[model samples]
Target: MNKHFLWFFLLFCLGAAAKSLKCITCHLHTQPDRCRRGFGVCIAQKHESCMILQIFQDKALQLTYMVCQQFCRDLTFDFNNRTYVHKCCDYSYCNYDM
Candidate 1:
């Protein structure tokens, strides 16, 4: 019984540690300072990185935001001639740099 309790306690601590990734989230258009939107903790399945994304329209910056994501790959996509660029990193509050 003691061994079982010990294992349960260890597993509980490990689970708590892995449960969430704290990240900063903001949209430049809505919150210009990029800090007013405050922080959010992500507990989604497979989410391992914090991401910063910038969307540009006709080479002009339109929007900037951050989120927690499962994949940490820099990517770009275009829609209606607008370009969306995403930069991602693993570690707490890493999106603040972007």
Candidate 2:
């Protein structure tokens, strides 16, 4: 009984430690593949995940946005010949460039 309890406690602690999220935050993304403004990291809150939004026009990359967002979902849409992609992830920096 003691051995089982110890293993359970250790596993629970590891799980809790893994729940924290760290994501890259960037606003003014430049064309040469760099963050020009608002570049940093954000510790995601409860129910939040790392997110990336990419906008493309004429099948070419127009802009890239990254942040930690709550209630984000993976999706894509097109408007006025522009394509918008919204992606979310739970792992650390998973949305950095994807």
Candidate 3:
């Protein structure tokens, strides 16, 4: 009756509010800025976000990787004379511009 209808409405509203995020995928060679190996799109699920990982060597861009990563974190660090940057976003196709 009314209780069932109320539950249904609430579930519908929650589903509408929780939208999935889309991300770009790339695994390529050192061609500067392009997706040469695995170029596609992914949909982020629960506890997942669109992520981009850029690798720099001697202040020069070496690689760019993008995907939908679970438990993603944004940070920057250096190791082996290379700099790594991780950026996470919650919007659809947000990693495309990174």
lDDT of 2 by residue, 1-98 (tens): 69999999999988976777989999878576789889998989998999999999998888899999999899999999999999999888887858
If both were scored by TM-score, which would come out higher, candidate 1 or candidate 3?
3
Q: Per-residue CA lDDT of candidate 1, range 21-64, in tens?
A: 66776644333444445455564347468888888888888777
lDDT value, candidate 2, whole model: 0.90
Writing each residue's lDDT as its tens digit, candidate 3 over 16-77 gives 75665778888663545457888898978889999988899999989888899999999999
Q: Model 3: what TM-score?
A: 0.77
lDDT of each: 0.73, 0.90, 0.86
Screening candidate 1 with a backbone cut-off below 3 angstroms (N, C-alpha, C), the clashing residue pairs are none
Candidate 1 RMSD to the real structure: 3.9
Query: Higher-lDDT candidate among 2 and 3?
Result: 2
In candidate 3, where is summed lDDT lowest over 10 consecutive residues? 27-36
